[model samples]
Target: MLLETGSVVAVEPDGLWVETIQRSTCGSCAAQKGCGQSLLAKLTGHTSYLWVSLAGRSADDYHIGDEIQLGVPEEVVANGSLFVYFLPLLTLLAATVAAHYGIGREGVTALAAIAGLLAGGALVRWRAYTTRHDSRLQPVLVDDRQVVQLVG
Candidate 1:
C-alpha cells in the first residue's frame, strides 16, 4: 500500500474530503533555458497537481481539519504514473523508428515521425488526464491521528 498524509478539507455525512498536492519535476530538470518543453509546462500549469480522496471507511470516522493518512495500492499508483509519463513517449519512439526504417523517402519518414509524435503525445496526455481526473481515492487504510500530508 502507498501512504500519503492529507488534511480533511471538508467533512460530509458520508465521507471526508482530502486534498493531495501535486509536485513537478521542472525545477529539477537540467535544461530549462529557452526550452519549448519547459515553457509549455509552465504555461499549462502542470507544475502541481491536486486531488481529493475519501477516507474509505465511514464518513463519520473523520472530521473537517483532521489530518489523516490515506493509503493507495502501489500497483495502482505505478501504473497510473507510468501510463501518463512514459506510454506516449514510448509510442512516439516506436512510431518514429518504425517509420524511419519502413519508409525509404526522407520526407515521408520525417512527416510520419512528427505526426506520430504529436498524435502519440496527445493520446498519452488525454489518457493520463482522464485517469487522473476520474480517479477516486480508495482507502487502503486511514489514520486520523496522522497529520495531513501528500504522500505521492
Candidate 2:
C-alpha cells in the first residue's frame, strides 16, 4: 500500500473529499534542471482532491480539516500508467501499418493514425468512466488510530 496523507475538504454521504498536495520528484532527479517535467511541475503546483469512500466508518467520525492517510495499490497505479501511455501508441502504430499496407497512401495513412490515436483516447476515457465506481480502483482509508506509537 502506498500511503499519502490528506486533509478532509468536504464530507460526502459515503465518503470524504480529501485535498492532497501533488509533489514532484524533480528535486531528487538528476535531470531536475534540464527536464520539461520540472518546469511543468512548477507551473502546475499542488492541491488535487480525491473522493475516498469510508469502508464501514460513519462520516460523523471525521470532521472537515481532519488529516487522514490513504493507501492505493501499487499494481493499480502501474497498470493504469501502462494502459494510458501504451494503448495510444500501440493503436497509432497498428493503424499506420495497416494503412500503409492496405491503402498504400501517405495522406490516408496519416489520417488513419490520427483516427486511431483519437480512438485510443476515447477508449481510455470510457475505461475511466466505467471504473469510476469500481472498489478495486478506489483508494482505501488508512486509519491512523490503530497505530501505537512508541514513546521512550
Best by TM-score: 2
lDDT by candidate, in order shown: 0.62, 0.84
- lDDT of each residue in 27-92, candidate 1, tens digit only: 665666665656766688643223344434456666766666678888778876787667667777
lDDT of 2 by residue, 2-88 (tens): 888888999987799997543444478777789665666678765568999876677888999898889999999999989998998
lDDT of 1 at 15: 56
Off by more than 4 A, model 1: 22-56, 102-111, 125-141, 144-152
Worst 10 residues of 2 by lDDT: 143-152
Clashing pairs in 1: 5-149, 6-148, 6-149, 14-59, 22-49
Q: Cα deviation in Å at residue 90, candidate 2?
A: 0.8
